[model samples]
Target: MKVELYDTTLRDGAQSEYISFTVKDKLRIAKKLDELGIHYIEGGFPGSNPKDAEFFSRVKEIEFDNSKIVAFGSTRHAKVKAEDDMNLRSLVDSGTDYVTIFGKSWDMHVRDALKILPEENLSMITDSIEYLREHGIKVFFDAEHFFDGYINNKEYAMKTLRAAEEAKASCLILCDTNGGALPFNILEVLNEVKGKIKTALGIHAHNDSDAGVANSVIAVRAGATQVHGTINGYGERCGNANLCSVIPNIKLKLHINCISDNQLKKLTEVSKLVAELANMSHLHNMPYVGRSAFAHKGGVHIDAVLKNPLTYEHIKPELVGNERRFLISDLSGKSNILAKAKELGLKLGKGSPEVKVILDQLKEMEKQGYQFEGAEASFELLLMRTLGLVKKFFVLDGFRIIVDTHYEELTSEGTIKVRVGNRYEHTAAEGNGPVNALDNALRKALEKFYPSLRDVYLTDYKVRVLDTTEGTGAKVRVLIESTDGKDSWSTVGVSENIIEASLKALIDSIEYKLHRTRGQ
Candidate 1:
């Protein structure tokens, strides 16, 4: 059977410690989820905050192609009737056809948190569903702490589900609310109550026990037709089961068609987009959509992948909009060098002397604290220089920087002279700091000959102290990442003097930018 995908990103994802999506963010994310072919999106509770209320109001302008919006709320209070409860009334006001209502299934919560009898909690469940059904809303019932309740009191838990099923809930979602249940526990409980109720079952898992994805996939194996989760697993208390992982496991591993082939190819792009909107860095090692997911580094593994990717990869990365990557490192062999050389448009054989020379230089530089794993531009430049294929755009004559401070304010100036094709150019510029001044002065001297440098700008600059024991005079490694609008590259430099290290990386970046202007 084709399983249903229910995403609670806007609702549960906002509960993550560092995640706070604005109304605009919710709309954009909801739109992305729709385009990616999700079936349901749980928008936040409108009654809880003005932001969510505004989101529901603004989202009406958007016409989704694939997803239906869902509003979330709890069961009616024990003392208040369903029609009189404000939270239930708000669910209807949210202007959604589908709604999810969570009710206490564990007797412990009923006796302690709700301070009510078990029968009263069941009535709350029935009343909430019945009220929403009467209002033309499709209700999805979340049995909060269902697994825990089943373990402590199987008969009571089963009774709660039967109440919702009889009350006409569209789907019964079993929630691992505390997020401590294991796969074995889920399977054990599910086996005991497989056909006790006629309602269709859904699984809502959490990651505190690190089995959310596993439990979700297993629930499908046990005959569930729907899975509830959030994108990137963002939620409270270790987050929910990651739909990024769960969807692929269902469609690719379990031989189920939960999502379309075209939708599967957009997974990586959507994952990165969501991370960007969340103001969080895309996790490098996240399954299916991470930068390091298909990266091969070891010598044997690199050779094997070049020959047959199936030896190291579970599936072709293109299936999920990701690509295979070969990492350059000390552990790399001739295969790695040859692969990188080919990627840079150079042809080299396994026994080529240039390969050994480049490998030796790479290892020596790594030992000197110059890392090329993230600095591929520097590695490419090294290959060109070693092969006598490098072009000298300009020859640096000399440069100097001066800094002075008055009160809390500071001023820095850099002067540089260069010979571009034997023509001399000298320039001076002031900046907020030494590095900035140097960059400004260098471009001032060279932009006349290489105007493409005008488009090149530093996007990221990082410095790592390689020898902390030396303290003030410790050697530092500087990595500078530059972009020319169309492409970006990283270069590295190592020196005890921070300014010198920065200058070295800056020069390499400029050279790379000039090379990019060429069709080569």
Candidate 2:
């Protein structure tokens, strides 16, 4: 049987406390998910919130190629009948062809959370599904906490699925809600459930124990026709099962096709785009699309991959919209240096003296906490310096900005001091904020040294509080990424004072650009 992958990134993924998508973002994501060739896209909970409901009403106008938008909701409230339940009614009016409804399956949950008898819970499940089917909507029944429900009371869990089955649930999704079940135990239950249910079966897993991917794969091996997951595993608590990991695993490892070759090429781009829209940093070690997924640094590995990429990499990075990178770091060997040199159109043979010199400087600089992993342009500069390509750029004659705040007067004072070439200049600027004043003053100082610096603008600045203490002291890391329309580079600074870190990175960005300009 062909396996179907259902993506709940927008619906379940929004359960993540940090993620919230605008209506347009949801529509854009829905179209991207369809582009990935997912069988179903769970958009959001239609009746639960205004944002989700607005998204669902607007998503009807979107054009999709191969995916059906699935609206998610609970089965029904305890006192309300499925036909009269406002939640179920909202799902019907949302204009989606398919709907997913979750019902309590664990005995503890049904008894304590709902305070209802087991038979009434079964009736709720049957009625909710039947009502959707009666309205010509495809229904996928999610037996919430199904794995734990099966473990505690196998008969009741099996009976609960029977209720959904009799009511014509298009598919029965068994959820590892708490994500505590091991693979072996999951396989055992999957096998048992398969023997009992004649309808299609699916698996929805969470990553609480860090085994979401493992359990999902094992469930598929035992016979799950569908797998549910979110992009990059973004969801409530630990996370949902990572479709990024599972898709490649199912296609490459099991030798089965989960999605078309064309759809797979857009995987990495979509992954990063979702992270950008959500304003969350992408995990660099994520299985298929991470920055370091195919990065090589060690000498032995680099040599082997150069000969045959399959010797080190499982899949070609291009297959998933990613690329191989040769990282330069302390652990780098001769092969690593040569590869990096080759990228810059320079030739360096193994055991070359030039390579030795470059490697030595890299190690010494790194010892002082200079990081090049995210600063490729800076690393290239280091290589040029080692090759004696240093040309005279304007000297950084010292510069400083001072800010003063007085609560009694409710006024702040700012001043900037600097030396340009052979002359010293002082500038004063006032702004609503101290940082704004400092930026203005620094730019004033630099314009005298290089007129072109005026055309270069600070396009983006980011500040992150790195470490926090109990109510008082904290360390901040500031990353200032700037662009000159054609090129962009990032610089970093870390200090206890937020202002100091921002200043350090800001200065580095300006200095690095001047250095590059001098070469040109």
Q: What is the overall TM-score of model 1 with all chains considered together?
A: 0.95
How many times do residue backbones clash in model 1?
A: 0
Error of 1 at 47 (Å): 1.3
> For each predicted model, how many residue pairs clash, with residues at least 3 apart or on different chains?
0, 0
What is the TM-score of each predicted model, taking all chains together? Answer: 0.95, 0.86
Cα lDDT tens digits for candidate 2, 188-209: 9999889889999999999999
Instruction: Name the lDDT value of residue 497 in candidate 1.
Output: 96
Superposed by TM-score, candidate 2 places the C-alpha of residue 364 at a distance from the truth, in angstroms, of 2.4
Global Cα lDDT for candidate 2? 0.83
RMSD per candidate (Å) reads 1.9, 4.2
Candidate 2 stretches greater than 4 Å from native: 388-393, 406-480, 484-488, 492-508, 511-520
> lDDT at 220 for candidate 2?
90
